[model samples]
Target: MKTARAAWRRLEPVHGMIYFVPEARRRYADLGLRGRAGYFASRSAAFGRASAELVISTFYNFNPDFVRQAVDGAWDAASPHQVLDARYAAVGEALRRAGIHELPNLNEVLALTRRAAEAACEHPQGRPLFAAHAALPWPDDPVLQLWHAQTLLREFRGDGHVACLLSEGVGGLEALVLHAATGEVPVGLLKSSRAWPEEEWADTEERLRERGLLDGDSLSSDGVLLRQHIEDRTDLLTLPAYGVLGDADCERLAELASPFGRAVVEAGLLKLG
Candidate 1:
């Protein structure tokens, strides 16, 4: 239902900003990370002691070679768990330093978010990818539970999006290209972050142009439709989790969460972009 999508839109700004917040990234660097490369390498490594390729291919949905290149020597510098711990600690520190108060009714938000997220595990049909994380014991701390719930919902939607993208023949840079076309992500940052060769990036753009999904520097009408289709499907896939609360509750959750997210944004700790 539209309410599910509406609720997700409201919650997204809060749960998703951690990845883009400058302070969080700075925290990783402070912990001895080597820049953007080390940040991705370490953060994505949180799932466990896995190869960079596997993490990229699974969690990041990026080219394995690119991730491998970025993580070439990161692990030797710091273990995965150490990096993961630092990332979490940094987020908390960043929030504190920003003076961004916790969400009002923190306990209520935590209870609601956790319950809805955990419900997804009960009937994870078509969402088997969430099984590992879903099975993890819930944290006792309300803030930690909130974080865990956010992570689970994110992965649940992400894995489904990846499956849909693959079916549409969009992988790695191509998927990034389409995402940039949507006007949400800046092309330059995506290009640099994915570590794609200039020529390869240009070639992909040309290919997309030929497919009528792109114009000189923007998505064509068809491109917009294609992107919308992908997004609509992604939203639909997330219904299994959001549905646990029903439409009214979903809106209530979103309403309760928006202020907390706004506080972080207002504090300049997180950027909507």
Candidate 2:
């Protein structure tokens, strides 16, 4: 299970970096998408004319009105096919800019990652985002293919995560509050990015406190337990995808993927702070 998490973490930047990469936004802008609309459009375009309501559900944690503003008529700017094209083009440009293509073991890493990613596509029962993406034709370029694989795996895990959170009674806002409390990401960044109002954020915190899941700005003991349980269940759900690769191969994948992931971060393509 730890191998599953570690492997995914090592490969995450390959896909995630594209969001912050300038090339991606530039292509989106070419298609008339501006501001956060590019983000909402580029990510959800895989859903072919997806309604804002659908994005609100799948994107979970973002303010619904904010989502509506971002995704409303997004397809009018560019068809889903065009949006997906621009997305992969960004992956290529950004990775090339980062000199990721120069790595000695790029092919080896992508091959292993793709195997697990394809295996994940086998069970898309409740993973809507993953299912939508898995249906797309595979990119001929190995670089784009690698990025596509990580995208599928992450979304697969994400869909399962939403299920776990809902089962644990953590609504999107509540989940964001708890995540903020963990100190992994600043509350200001989350609140600003998600467009959650200060009043709502505070109210969510207060409600969490009332439920004994929060103490001040952090998680209470019960909250800690619940968070752990959610993550554990999420890991368990994502495990079967990696299971096809077995523990040893997954470890090798992590080892091979780690340097590239770190290289992406070091290249300043993905500024987390």
Candidate 3:
């Protein structure tokens, strides 16, 4: 489990930088996907004309109305195949700019991450988003392939995370409120980014209070314990994919990928939500 987490913690930036970069927005706009529409569209492109409800279910933490608005007419504006092409192009541009191609052990990191990603493909029973992505043909370029690999790992962990959240009876907004209590992200950012209205956000918090998961703005002792359990379970769930790497290779994956992740951050490619 530690290995699973360490591997994800390092590779996440490699996959996550797509959301914050200007390149994504510009490319999505070129495809007529405006605002957050690009995010929902490009990420869910593998679904090929996925409905908003499907996006909401897979994405999990976002507001249903906001997700609907994003996915509405998205496929009409751009086909899933086109969105898929555009997103790869955008990532390529970003990675080239960030000097990812110039990094040492680039091939080595790619090899490891790809191996882990393939392992994820084996057990897709309830992991919808990951299963959708895992079906896509691999990109030709090694760098793009590396990005795709990390993307798989991220989605694999994410799908498991959503399941864990559901098992804990944590809805999207309630999960966000609990996340805010831990201070991993600011309350304002989490609420606004997910498009939860202030009233709805407060209402969610009030409900958490009633359930004794929250004490005012902070997580109560019980809430903290539950949150820890959720995280532990999420990490454990990822082991089936990462366990194939064994502990040493998992740690090595992190060490080799650290510089690449740092390059993205140093290049200022990453943005806070």
Candidate 4:
């Protein structure tokens, strides 16, 4: 059982629960739970035409009894505690406009979204909010770009393309060194750099070595991996905050960077400089 569970965990995407929000809302409402009704409504509204079917499905799933109570205002005299369910439903409806759809089983999604919303609310300065929005591309906030970059690095771990890219930029070198310290680089490569000139390459190498790019000898075990990570991240850096990349701009930037840009393309990274 434990092995099966572990396998399942590995197979599941990081935020799988959120993906089924629309279905979860319907299931709960059908069972007479009003706690998330309003929430689902609000989410539906936010998603607009993209998720209209999901929103309507949630509405029809609402408990008939709860619907009646709401229409008749029978719970108006109830204490706050007694009326909490209604409050949640109302709030959910408001949030529906913000793209929070009903999921198939929302316990996890609710917990996740609630925490995110709370954090966003606390900041209210728009930066955190924007970050939250941007986080939609990943499973969760913590995973963001770095996690994606690492995943790409792992996919192309031994490719020479990654190594060549790391050899190019000071920033890339620094990032590789950092990965080395974390054991994300390969150890053998760290041992090979010894033949290179100490005086000419000393400063940059020392800086990267300090950051853990180099071990006692060649590139650290993580050097190649980190190089790949940096290359992947560099491609992302040129992308818009919303994650869109313009082909024309990419072409122009690539042209400007010339061989460097072509190298990025060959590495299968973004075409933009």
Model 3 over residues 140-177: C-alpha lDDT tens digits?
A: 99989999999999999999999999998999889999
**Residue 211 of model 2: what lDDT?**
99
Tens-digit per-residue lDDT, 36-71, candidate 1:
665565546545555676667675545567777767
Deviation of model 4 at 243, angstroms: 28
Clashes in each model (backbone N, CA, C under 3 Å)? Answer: 0, 0, 0, 45
Task: Name model 1 segments beyond 4 Å from true.
Answer: 21-23, 26-31, 60-63, 98-101, 123-132, 271-273
Off by over 4 Å in 4: 1-105, 124-173, 185-204, 210-214, 217-273
Give the alpha carbon lDDT tens digit for every residue of 115-146 in model 4. Answer: 32333333323232133233433334322222
Minimum summed lDDT over a 10-residue window in model 3 is located at 264-273
TM-score of each candidate structure, all chains considered together:
0.86, 0.98, 0.98, 0.22
| Candidate order by decreasing lDDT | 3, 2, 1, 4
Over 155-231, each residue of candidate 2 has an lDDT whose tens digit, in order, gives: 99999999999898799999999999999998899998999989999999999999999999989999999999999
Q: Which scores greater on lDDT, model 1 or model 2?
A: 2
lDDT of each: 0.70, 0.89, 0.92, 0.34
Question: After superposition on all CA atoms, what RMSD does each candidate show versus the true structure?
Answer: 2.8, 1.1, 1.1, 23.2
- Winner by lDDT between candidate 3 and candidate 2: 3
- At residue 146, candidate 1 shows an lDDT of 70
